[model samples]
Target: MPRNDAPDDQAPVASSPPTRLALIVRGGWEGHHPVAATELFLPVLRESGFEIRIEESPDVYADAGVMRDVDLVVQCMTMSEISREAVFGLRDAVAAGTGLAGWHGGIADSYRGSSDYLQLVGGQFATHPSRAPEDRPGDERDNFLPYRVEISEAGREHPITAGVGDFELTTEQYWVLHDDLIDVLATTTHPVQPYHPWHRPIVSPAVWTRHWGEGRIFVATPGHTPEVLEQAPVRTIIERGLLWAARTPSE
Candidate 1:
């Protein structure tokens, strides 16, 4: 007894508009090459129809009006302290539907003094254990090692991980303290080493997403240097993750 057609009084639904604005806040420890790392994705973001705004300071987070209007915020700061005003502004903005996304130490390791920031990020960087050379006890420059990143079953089906297979890379395998609510997409296992406490294979999330109020949070932990970001899988994951976090429609 149901009619096949819609009633004449019903109005047509409108399609969601394309993502318009994005803010990239980059600064803090130069070791991560925050500026260069963020620049690598500029082209892709532009091509995807975003008007990007780049900032070298965290003060931008304090701009409540600007924060409220931006569709997405991509932070690239590392080990920096955020002002109380900036912290509160950012927290409130994201809670009100502005998406937040970042990679490496930018989101995870930043603002060690702020628990509110950490709660929004859903994780914290504990340590990046390096392979110390036995011959050179004092020289510890090259601490990075090659490791494999395995995609989770959920990731294999997710839009961000589409066409992405498990990949290997020579970089810092981050040991992160993460929230229980995070939906883990991929992970890496830490090998037993003299520098680390875990003797057995300890797995950690390499990519994940968490929800804070109405906003979405995305984090990818593999980018320690620019070379790491050049890897096909790493680049793909980051690009996709950025779009996903921004609430953009992904084809």
Candidate 2:
């Protein structure tokens, strides 16, 4: 018969798992407001049990020891240069399973001079067409235009974008030049306006992902400012993207 009393020797209590490490490498063009933009997501990162390490330079990417244990990298540096050593170190870290994710020019338009870096990111920001002279407002509004981000069939099934319907934004719509290696999740089309030179509507990838070796990468062409990043749908997508891109136990 089973005894009512508990056994003298008890099973060991399972301890909570350790928190993952997330490295936030941000700095470069102040226009992107990297600090504010990245800070908006700190709570999301912390709530997910991430031990955050913030850095203002890409040089941190060159630190092999640090990169080795990093589970994720959130980069926001735009229009800056990264050294060869740093590029290789970053590349190696991701290829070895460290996730990398960023938005707008922070990832797509960064390091214009580093082909290796471009190859790793799989895209480059060509330009965001501004209003014609007659319509120019002589301010940030000059480049701000309303556009729709349409979700692809794959995005509807992907964890990062699932349930997030197509949204509209009155912001800079990046024209990214990318190759076939990327998995496009969303796209934006620039319509031919009477003031613009383009003859027809042009569609560009607005959000995408790439698989590099054992790692994963995510990019969203929105988030031009902190306010934009704060939008419900954009914030939701970004938060999910960050977690989805993190290094998994098996990876």
**Which stretch of 10 consecutive residues in model 2 shows the poorest summed lDDT?**
4-13
Which runs of model 1 end up more than 4 angstroms from their true locations? 1-19, 135-141, 248-251
Write one digit per residue (lDDT tens) for candidate 1, span 127-223. 8777756633453235577788999999999899867999998777898998799999999988887766776977899999988887888999989
**Which stretch of 10 consecutive residues in model 1 shows the poorest summed lDDT?**
134-143
What RMSD does each model have against the real structure?
Answer: 5.1, 1.6
TM match of model 2 to true structure: 0.95
lDDT of 2 by residue, 1-251 (tens): 98776665775668876789999999999999999999998899999889999999999999999999999999999988999999999999999999999999888889999999999999889999887777778998799888899999999999989999999998998888999999999999988888777899988999899999999999999989998899988899889989999997555
* Cα RMSD of predicted structure 1: 5.1
Against the true structure, candidate 1 reaches a TM-score of 0.88
